[model samples]
Target chain A: MNKSDNNFLGRWLANDLSEKEKKEFENTPEYLAYKDILKGVDKFERPVFDIEANLQKQKEYNQTYLKNVSKGSKVIKLRPWLYAAAAVFLVLIGLRTVFFNTTTINTNFAETKTWTLPDNSIVTLNAKSTIEYNDRSFTNDRSITLDGEAFFDVAKGSQFTVKTKNGAIKVLGTEFNVYSRNTTIEVQCYEGKVSVNNGKNQAILTPGKGVTSIDKSALNSVEIKESEPGWMQQKSTFNQVSLGRLIAELERQYDITIEKGDVDTDRLFSGFFTHTDLNTALKTCFEPMNINYIFKSSKTIELKNR
Target chain B: MPEQQVSVCDESIYDQLYREHAEKICYYLYYKYGDMEKAQDIVQDSFAKLWMNCSKIIFGAAKSFLYKIANNASINEAIHQKTVLKYKSTPQKTYTNESPEFQMEEKEFMDKLNQAISGLKEGQREVFLLNRIEKKTYKEIAEMLGISVKAVEKRMHLALVTLRKKIGKI
Candidate 1:
């Protein structure tokens, strides 16, 4: 709607016109057309947004966002220069690129490696673990079939899933560690929300909450304190886990064969081991049980009663 | 600090910020940049940036951070085009009583008005539509654009003037 006095029109649009100005403006022929124009424009349909869907896709963009706001007042604490850090991080991004095919990466005994997924999500496999994904469709369907144990730092994108023989852990974007071997599957969510589903059991896990299923019977909620897996920090921790399973982990980690000499392998052990030192690991694992370990050979350890 | 500071990392607080500002940021970019999809993408990217820098940003300054990030990203990549806005008109009761000829005349006038709106300079068009359609006050527009209220008023005045000139017979 138009009037010759555009300044008056502007004031009128702002609803700041005087009574006389309003009356005179209303009397003008252009007033109706202007009103029509304003009324017509008001009906313009904004593009429809699937807000929840958008939130799902985008809500997890925290880890690698590059720019640091230069203004100090805008930030409570400005981080130090991240460009050098970013350069180092860029090197951490795996150089292996496989598109339109399936890539199965497995670690050897006492070996672990970090592989950046097609979408830049990073997965660091624990020793003797294997992770497989279709690189072609990974951007769309981010499903990784995991064999053993792995800590995942999933990028913000589509729904990411870690399927195992026992169960599957599904998340949109977050970090979590999964231990899936034989009939035991344990998932600990370090960051964000995760939904774990075994064939007969299902549970929703928020950060620090986890679920453990042994022998495929049922799921039990496990409370944890650490923000991330202990193994990520060079320590393999256990909470009442079986001595046999713990021994298996120790073997995978140390790359050594253990001879169970009179030590009940089925006994539950509640302790941890450092990957840095084997002697320390052995003491941490077997000392509480009053068990002793003798070095049978250069690469073999024999466990026996004290 | 005696009381706890609001952390943007908290899901509930972050969700609240998203609900409050996401649409506004999207619409602002769409209005200024004239690409709905690109506006949305920039919005998502900026929010991602927000999440990335959540810890450093105080809750008080988050809104400006979002808009600034979105504005920068939108400006860098996208090119402005004719903003062909679609109006979802509610059928008016007055239209039912109007003569068929008068109804057609009204529809034709609306068509010309739509063309004029698209033909107007994009900044002025954005200001005008944000005022009329989004119901944003001149003060709010000024704050959003980091400008004086008088500048927004000028854009508003110019928008109306250009629209009037483009469709003169009205």
Candidate 2:
């Protein structure tokens, strides 16, 4: 074998080499190089998990036992708590539509509804959140005003638009989630091209691109990261996100406050979260650096030095 | 109650498939698209579509089916989200002011790597990324990309050869 082949084989040998390859690579220099690269690369383990919840969900969906049990029942009997959870989930899922159509759409704690727009677009309205569309007719020009959070799967048509208080997003047949509240408008595009315009500033977003808008101005900053929606999917991707910005996102996502005084605000973090619990998310951000958080209420959290 | 045999429809199977593969699919999507939120949203939609076509997909082939859906979703998402290209330096900045020798060495190595990777036929790069980064087994990759496992192995071998040649030590 050539030197390169020998090296490759040697490296393979070091890394739990199968019985067959070990004898051949014992004296290879190429194997040594490969070993070094493997060692270096091994240090950078890509964070991954088995996704137990998803697996369970899949098992439930695919398991013969559950299928048989649920087949005849008109309403698959679930835990009473699950009914509430499902209702909330449905509302959250539907929140995307409400944000797309009306000038001002609002839901109370007990409300969950799906709004089908003029373009046959679907959105799920969430509780205690409001969305409004600026234009009366969405046929000629599609645009809506949003105040809270919404998920959207815009029907592929000529051109669809969603306008928020801080900025307006123009898209052509894309799926995305938009959250515009508290002077920060966040747009995460899952599919299609979305143009986010805040007055004079405009950012055209492709899939896996997001822009954060401040003060109803153009996207002040743009981030490119792995494609994952925040609410529905298990994993959330964060690029080089500032501590303040991350805290704000956490607040919106979990409806909790994260006080900034105790933590170093300058540090930027890049990582992924896969169906991480709220406590886990908080801990992942705080524990490594020895920072601490104090919960003021369900709605408020303050970060302080330990 | 007598046990009733429930025939799982395509929808349930599809839902199951999505639930199974969404995480990895999302991860891949994130890397390809460069946005986590977008990846998640697209993955969910992709799975939803799979659920819509569950009956046509075989249970044994669900993993490949999900990957296909994810690939298509990412491509579609990319095409729809068009932009006027403007140069924005990636935040993962390379040192621009290093010693000339070091910089040149780094540049040369990177150029060689790029040249080697790009020189390979398109199929080779696809296979290499799928195998190396995506960590797909040869069988799964072959089935997904629609080629023989031997062909997949050949491409991978060729890719490694080119990469090693460009790096000069191999």
Winning candidate number (lDDT) = 1
lDDT (Cα, tens digit) per residue for candidate 2, span A1-306 = 344542343234224356566666556555564444333222222334346555555444445544554585568568899999999998987875564444556755324346777778876554346766544466667766666667788998887777776777888898777777677778888788888887878888888777876677656555555454544554445667666766665665565656787477767777655334777877776676577887788767888877
TM-score of each: 0.45, 0.36
Cα lDDT listed for each candidate: 0.82, 0.61
- lDDT tens digits by residue: candidate 1, A126-202: 99999988877777889989999999999987799899999888999999999999889999998899999998888
Residue-level error in angstroms, candidate 1, position B45: 0.7
Which portions of model 2 show Cα errors greater than 4 Å? A1-104, A107-115, A124-129, A134-136, A216-228, A234-236, A257-261, A264-267, A272-276, A294-302, B1-170
Question: Which ranges of candidate 1 are over 4 A from the true structure?
Answer: A1-6, A60-306, B1-4, B80-82, B91-100
| lDDT (Cα) of model 2 | 0.61
Q: Write one digit per residue (lDDT tens) for candidate 1, span B1-31.
A: 7225789888888888888888888888777
Give the per-residue lDDT digits (tens) of candidate 2, residues B1-170: 22122222544544555556788776555444445567666665655555545556556666776778777777777775522211121233565666789756654554444445444555665666555556777777677667787676667666565556556652
Indicate which candidate wins on DockQ: 1
lDDT of 2 at A128: 43
Instruction: Report the CAPRI category for model 1.
Output: acceptable
